[model samples]
Target: MLSLFLVALASASLLPGGSEVWLARQWCQEPAPLALWAVATAGNTLGSLINVALGRYARHFQGRRWFPASPQGLARGERWYRRFGEWSLLLAWAPVVGDPLTVLAGVFRLAWWRTTLWLLVAKGGRYALVLWLADAWLAPYC
Candidate 1:
């Protein structure tokens, strides 16, 4: 359980991949889907919070060439933000664009609670859907 949380945490941060794979494996082995879901959701949410904090703090250093946020990436995220408004944070679970959206929300000083709510819905829904699909996929074999 702790491993799942930590793994989900690592994946949730700026790192790639997601907790889904870890989640499905745990579900199949132990069937503790609820506990696993909670851990993964909390860990992933905390990770996004980290990005939010980073974006909030980075307001000062964004223009610096040494900053890790790439210019192109920021530009793209900004465009997305402009197009969708803060609601774009709802897609925070999406790959490629998702991480940047979280940071962008922070950069814009968006309401953290709103972003978090969207994230919870998206991330939690994703886990539930993945679990359902996993069961469906693995059912016939098992």
Candidate 2:
């Protein structure tokens, strides 16, 4: 469980890691799908919270002359946030854009509880889908 949590946390951060492989391997070993899902979701959610804090802190650095600015970039992010609002946290599982999205939520000062809830839904759905696929494709092989 500890290893699973660590893998999920690391994968959710801005790091080159993924818990999916570990999840599949562990499932193969013990077949405790529900437990695996819970651990992964908890770890991923906690890691995402870290990204949110980072984004909140980044607000302090924005608009400094030393930092580059692009109205186009800011505008695009704003448009996205406006369109999705707190629900945008669901996209927090996306590859490249995931971590940044969480940070944007913090920078925009969106409601923390709402953001956390949506993030859990999104991340949990992702883990469930991955586990389902693994069960479908790999179970027979195992």
Residue 100 displacement (Å), model 1: 0.7
Best by TM-score: 2
CA lDDT, every model vs. true structure:
0.79, 0.84
Candidate of highest lDDT: 2
Per-residue lDDT of candidate 2, residues 32-116 (tens digit): 8899999999999989888888877877777776744466776677677777767767888888888878878877767778878
Q: Where does model 2 exceed 4 Å of error?
A: 70-80, 83-85
Q: Candidates' TM-scores?
A: 0.81, 0.86
lDDT of 1 by residue, 42-93 (tens): 8888888788888888877878989866778877766776668577766777
- Pull out the clashing pairs in model 2: none
Error at 124, model 1, angstroms: 0.7
The weakest ten consecutive residues by lDDT in model 2 span 65-74
Q: How does model 2 fare in lDDT? A: 0.84
